[model samples]
Target chain A: MSITEIIIISLIKIVIVLGITLITVAYLVYFERKIAAWAQNRIGPNRVGWQGILQPFADVFKLLLKEDIVPERANRIVHAIAPMIALFVAFTTYAVIPIGPNVNIFGYDISLVVADVNMGVLYVLALTSLGVYAITFAGWSSGSKYSLLGGIRSSAQMISYEISMGFSIGGVLLLAESLRPIDIVNSQTNLWNAIVQPIGFITFVVSAFAETNRLPFDLPEAEPELVGGFHTEYSSMKFAGFFLAEYANMVIASAMIVTLYLGGWHLPFEQSLGLSGIWLTVAQIASFFVKMGAMLFFFIWVRWSIPRFRYDQLMNLGWKVMFPLSLINIIWVAAIIMIFN
Target chain B: MSQTSNSLKKRKKDLTFWQKIYIPEIAKGLALTFKNMVRPKFTMEYPEEKFIPPPSYRGRPVLVLEETGEERCVACGLCSRVCPALAIEVQAAETEREKERYPEKFEINMLRCIFCGLCEEVCPEEAIVMSKDYELAFTNREDAIYGKDKLLTPVSQLEDRIEFLRKYK
Candidate 1:
């Protein structure tokens, strides 16, 4: 394909992925509430449009109408840029994810991704780590002691969890023998990596929760302590941006889980389906979505079922538990591979 | 008998590597929460459904009356003197030549009443009692002020008083 045509195709994929991400983030909030209510034996938002499906939209409208207030002593530029950076980094991580195989679109074979970079896994890791910058900047720029403390806590929490997160991926790299996302899925043709590296999977899942700053690891945004945390001073669209970034990160984490462990875009028995043409691609895409949905549900399930961890407890669990477990898991995988190969 | 637990406490040491990870404990916590999720809820839908008041509940105050439509209160002024909230007021008047005291005006400011049933307890002739009529919301201050007729109970429930008055007369 010509360079111009490739660029156009990439643009289309970017638009589509962003659109999907936005819609999913909106509905994910609703899904979280419904699941939480069901867990707590209470009726959640059912007033808005047919079982509260439009409640998120109503919330968005309310947020938009609210006054955009920037504190007098706040660093104006940094305050404005923090949430945007967070949101941008979150949206960019989805570029490497393959929703489906190449398909004929208007007489051109168009790939179902924005970019198929060889170092997709490292790219995702790097972008996720950058998320801390947004929170840190937001806290520092707000000129408030509470925001600063929250930012510091968030950084500490994220850095500690990130070590395990990176180490957990080492197992996937060992099994797949490649850092490429598509290659990882291709390696799991016979068996999913989740079954083989169950411990690593668990570590990854826990680390993902911490990385996203979700409960029970959501101490940075603990309402009673830090109010609204780093974004406490934010208002209007700026505040909405932080919320969007959080849900978007959740979506990205779920997508990564599907890609790394559950075998992205690969059905259980692809050969048996035997249906050629676009049908296989369609089935693969559907399978990818199903895995992503299941992971998202698990995220919401854990959030509602558990209480937020205390700061000391959270730090202890990350450093004293998850870190050591991840290390052992990596060493075990390496030893097994050495013994077999 | 208490010394039995000291042995277990002394034996409890640092957690093993596996236990420190808390995978099993986390699983247990998850199980507990999941169990709670399925259990019956404790929520109460108000407005649409009213709660059944207990037998000991002290609701609104009402004055008893005879079947002949005579007031059981004899304008005694005892309920007024004993009321802690000073909610009761009575002005006595002479009836005919008998010098029998009857209230020219009687009122009970419900907003001021503490619902302690103190007046009911202090009534010598059981002339005033609390009834199960608690839906007494009022929009205006004046509306909450209960007059003699409104505070009086129905004659049907004062059958004994009606018969006693007939026999005594």
Candidate 2:
């Protein structure tokens, strides 16, 4: 492809991805409220615009109009930049996640992903780890006990959980024998990783919850203990950035889970229907999103249903339980591959 | 520790291998929540659909206007004396009626009123009773202190509550 053409294509992809991510994040919050209401036998937001469809917009506008208050003793530069870093990391990680198979678009073959890097998985892991820095910076810079403790808790929780998460991913990596997410998705055409390795899937899902700082693993922002946690001092748009980042990270986690274990865009027994060209690609992408949506629902469902684990219990589970289970999963995968091959 | 020390029989049952796995329990919980998601929502959309409180429901307090368009209050100040929140302010005036007295100025601070139904209970003439106007919103303190203009309701509107009070009280 020519330089300008490549630039144009990249720009288009960036815009499309960012737009979709933002909109999805907004609706995710709405659905979270709705589902929570249903589970608890209460009416959710439905007054603003046709069952609260415009609720998220109203929320954004309200946040924008609010005063951006910074703590008197806060490190102004770092405190301001923390949420931006979090937002940046959350959105950028979506670049390598393949939403669908390649398709011929106006004569040029285009992959659905923004970037098809060879080490896409590694890039994702790296970016997610950098997300910790944002939390830590927010906590430390805020110069408040609550924010500082929240930041400290988040870093500790993430690091411990990430170990188990990485080990669980090892089983999938062993099977695919490639770090490229597209290749991993292609390998799952016959058998999904979740089916072959249930243990790893469970641990990975748990770790993903902790990584996203969701409820049941949401000790960092446990309102009873930490107030608003790391973002306690943040108000207005700065707070919104962290809020957006958290939801966006949930999206990325769901997408990753779908791509890794649920066979990504590949659907079973679609050959009989014989979809061709653009139609086939569209079907593939739709399948991927459906899987992702199911994961997202599960995330929210688990959040509302289960109570958060105690801090000591959380550490014990991460180190004593998940870490070992993931290691065993790797061994089990290795044995299965050897026996079969 | 306290629970464990209380009684041997109160101890948690030793978890079986299957129970220890916890997957089944998690699945059960997930199934329950999923079932709830599809179940009928108990949401009552307010404003659009106001709930008609039953006859026994105690809502805002109002003075009862009789069939003759005259208030039943004797201006004895029993309601004012009984109001725990000091919500009701009654000024008695000499009247030419059979009761010989009436409230010249009757006011109830909606904000101060705790909806305890004490004033209604204390009214000797069955003059003041709770009405079904539960949607009481006031933007200012002045607006909240409802005078006779806001508190007086036609006897017909509170007949059910009146009937209920007569039967039960």
- Where does candidate 2 stray beyond 4 Å? B1-13, B94-99
Error in Å for residue B127 of model 2: 1.4
lDDT by candidate, in order shown: 0.85, 0.92
* Residue pairs in collision within model 1: none
Comparing chain B with the reference, what is the TM-score for each candidate? Answer: 0.67, 0.88
Residue A258 CA displacement from its true place in model 2, Å: 0.9
Summarize candidate 1's per-residue lDDT along A272-338 as a digit string, tens digits: 8797988888888999999999999888888876789989888888898788888888887898788
Residue B169 displacement (Å), model 1: 31
Q: Ten-residue segment with the worst summed lDDT in candidate 2 chain A?
A: A269-278
lDDT of 2 at A183: 96
Measured by DockQ, the strongest candidate is: 2
Best by TM-score: 2
Clashing pairs in 2: none
Can you list each candidate's DockQ? 0.39, 0.71
Candidate 1 lDDT tens digits, B139-158: 99999899987988875754
